[model samples]
Target: MKFNIKNRVTLLVSVWMMSFTMNMLEGVCSIPSSLEVFEHHKNVTGKKWAVLVAGSNGYENYRHQADVCHAYQILKRGGLEDDNIIVFMYDDIAHHPKNPRPGIIINEPNGSNVYDGVPKDYTGEATNAQNFYAVISGNRSALSGGSGKVVDSGPNDTIFIYYSDHGSTGLVSMPEGDDIMANDFMDVLMEKHATNSYKKMVIYLEACESGSMFEGILPNNINIYATTASKASEDSWAFYCPDYGLPPPPEYTTCLGDLYSISWLEDSDKNDMTKETLQQQYQIVRRRTLIGYKDFHSHVMKYGDDKLKNDLLANYIGANPSLDENAYSFEPSTTQTRLVNQRDAHLLHLRLELQMAPEGSKEKLKARQELVDEISHREHVDNTFHLIWDLLRDKNNNSTMMLNVRPPGKPLVDDWDCFRTLIKTYENHCGRLSSYGKKYTRVFANMCNAGIYVEQLKATTSQVSIPLTSSSTQTLDLSSIGSSFPTSATLQELELVTSIDEELLQEYGDELHRFGKVQRVFVVSLKDRSSHMLAMTTSFLKGDYQDELRFFRVHKSDVYESQVAVTKGIGKYDVANGYAEIKVVDKVGFSTKGGKVTNSKFLLFHIYLS
Candidate 1:
């Protein structure tokens, strides 16, 4: 084992090199003084810019605008000048008829008006998704109309963006317009990065399912940090809800702030911005937002650059107390507070309105009906999807309904195109899924998670129909139906109260389609015992009679010849003996030249798919 002097020196050198490599691999722990030379440690050298957007309108959504206005106050106090800040709010709240203080808007209980000095760079319809993207990407031409303000920043600028609104799984609503879908927003961020818009950006989102905006799309290297009020599949909570008996001021009947939003704003208000870091504020806010509401707790989430956590709050918010003369103090209470689900906030408000109104009065009855309708609408959506789920279960032997697969605490469908398509289809047929339709996005998400194709889900929906309950059924006397309404005396209409055979239903199903897609058919039946009839109506496309299902029954007097009359009307060979030939019009709903067309009264003998 004895080695020569040269070998021994080689061994010692090798050992020394190995030790050096190990030290390099496991980064050497350095003292704070030694780390001062690191570029990140040096004070962030940049001018600050901000974009605060409140992407919702209406008085019940008071919290969104209030959140944005409050954030504006914080950034302004932090010394970011008005010239450097861009604000986009619906701007309807300050002067809203519902506002007790017409010109002032408040965030916290008895809080000072954040709306007083706020800028209205993009207001009204101008505060839409198009302007939002335009502002983010600095694309003046992309915006249809607005203040034409955008983020005019360089690599040295730090940008802070705060958006408060109503959000579905992958969409944030813009007032009077389409939503800010995740894909589009992600594209804007990428464009901003490519154009060297900012050195770093901090985004705060206060909306239901806000985390979906960044969940799988945001890249960690994008120099962006996002903190959302709720996770990918949960509702963000609304706080200071007077409807639930917790109001900052007595007259404030709606929610004043989002739980996650107000938590951070209040924390910013109380803490020394110079001393506190963004990480500390996030932790405080996250804790406060999740405190005590375990039954329906919204999990706050953070995405992108973990390193940005150590950045000073003052770097983005501002440290100049002198500039905060208009800012008011906020004391967050841990007790006697309630949180409202964003989807149900308005319903709760209506419920409270009903309770406060004089008993049995018109206003009270109206409020009660509104509350009931709201509740019923939500239930109807759930019930409709449940019906689809039941049909799918029956058709597939209960195999594809996602009953066995457990989803994450929050369920989300990561496929954007598929989700968009499914949602659009639902909207075209069912109605806008926002507000009442928001929560049902999860049904599609579940379908996606279960490895079910959107096409299959849509097709399933097409085949399903809502049957009227026995209690809702009315036995119509066909003889007297539609007699009260005017119709053409030359044409006789016969009402048939009968059920179609499965074979006939299958034949009709083959002809049914959606959006002109020959193969797609969605059947939705009336909740009342109403009948749909297949009419030999004159086609607007061909100017000839075609077989089409008319949900409304035609009366004898209501069936009239068109203003542009045809000598050879719909022949008996083209339709049934008792069937009336009718002309098509440009408007929706079945209308006749007669006095008025009444609703169908016959029990439509339509075939039902098993």
Candidate 2:
């Protein structure tokens, strides 16, 4: 970047300004000046890269040498520094051994052209699989190793684990059975970076049947994404069929080496895209690869059975918090499992059935709600199923996950009195959404802790527990353990949907007092275009605690003209998920358009407990 002094000064100002704003809005109202650590970014550490590759040179390899060449193009693209890169490949005839395909060659105006292939053992036959592995592990002689070096880690790094290989249903093997343990490789990858503090890790796999690799992957601190080839067996043949490359080059089956690789990674037509952009583009191709493979397979089979296909699909995908294909792969013993969730709704079939039973016909409404509440609150617990999937997802695929929720399953149900009486009790104890975000940290912490409680419920019920000797001992109550979990921090913003009712605010206000001191409540009325924003203090909401609360008001003009209410003070922090429940009141306060009011849309409320 050849920047003039003017440009450098502008960047400094921009970075400083944005940092200041973020700190202030997040309630960091004070910052010390003249810290020695503020300057000297030169002291910050650099980064590193990790790469993996496997190649073949039989009939397909003979025809797709362009693929080998493409790998070089990817290495040279963007700002990927040379010292940081590691390349694993089987790009020459010796590694190709039997039959060698001519590899592709790329020339960067300012970069090294790296696809020069070596001679010997030349033929049209595919390379022996052993050479491929040997080449990657650095077992070859001088001038006979990888396209790049072997790198494991760095202070703050960016790792790229890429592959282009041939595969079958569950394995990538050479005709001679030289396949590495796919699961083992994934485990090693994640284990290598167990602490997961890298800036990001990118896994770009180009192989047949590669899509299935998503199973059993666990990431450390990296984001794991792969081409649909991860599931189905796929070849990177440059032109075996008419419908393969991006936009299906009219007559291709195997994806050739140089096409997607060179164009996207190396010579991307979009100059504006950076290394970061290239990483994201990999996702687009990964999904498209899956749909493409499925389509190709379907075209070959000619089977239009939706149910059969869905069952076949269920053979692979799952959400047990582990490998989907593994858990859902097996049919549950009972018909209950099959019929219970056919509609794809979040409702738990057993609980819903009990709920709809006569309010008196079943074991009583209390018993039914207890059962419903248990399942609805599944998010708070970690069950065997969660454990199962976590163990099975391909370690590479789950590296740095961003979704903030328990693995999706039972707790996926909606929260309401229908599920938990505590919800109702808490509301009645406080008021309504009023105590939301104010004491939010405390409130949600208990809710999160409640999840800990449910796990105890399951633990006590586990069949493997040894019976304790009893003389004159009291029976243990598992619920007591449930109450021992942690409390989370308060969220800065808690805007409820416009539909929530305003009248319930007071009750929520009271319930939230459990977390910490209640400060203030900011409610914008949904009823009228001119509805004034209400600032309720602790004294106004809680008659007894009024004396303990401190209140401050800023001029109307001083408040930012934004709907997001910023929480202040030391306890403010982010939550695992949006800990506060969001509801759309049956009324509308504002229309879909931001303008005009009269009908109720919803209200915003947040809660934070200590």
TM-score of each: 0.67, 0.33
* Residue-by-residue lDDT tens digits, candidate 2, 1-610: 2344356457446656766777899988554231211222212434435443544443333223444344434344423444444444334432332222234322222223345532222122223444433333333442232232435354364455555554432234332323433443454455445555443445555444344344324332234433333333233322222222232232221222322333233323232231223334444343322233332321011111111211110011100111112111111122211111101112232333344345556454454444434332331122222331232223224422211223312121122222233323323332222111111212222333333232332332231112122223122222332221112111211332222212222212112123233344433433443333433223223344433222112112122221212222221222211112222222212222353322322222233333
Give lDDT per model, in order: 0.64, 0.31
- Candidate 2's C-alpha runs over 4 A off are 1-45, 50-52, 62-65, 93-148, 174-177, 195-199, 219-255, 258-271, 275-283, 286-610
Once superposed on the true structure, which residue ranges of model 1 sit more than 4 Å away at CA?
A: 1-44, 243-246, 292-296, 322-337, 358-362, 393-411, 449-457, 463-610
Question: Can you write out model 1's per-residue Cα lDDT over 1-610, one digit (the tens) per residue?
Answer: 2244355357446655655666678896423221222222224467778999888888888889999999998878777789879999988888998788899999977788889788879988788888888888878888877677788888888889998888877788888577888888998999899888789999999888788788877888989999999888678888878745346676765788888888788778777676677788888877767764545468889998877887777777777354333334444455555668888788666756666667658976586556645554555566566656775666556554533323443325656677677777766655567575676665666566656676776665554322222332222243443422224321223432122121111112212222110111112123353322323222222333333322224322222221111112233323222223222111111122354332221121321111
Number of the top lDDT candidate: 1
Weakest ten-residue segment in model 1 by summed lDDT: 515-524
- Model 1 Cα shift for residue 199 (angstroms): 0.5
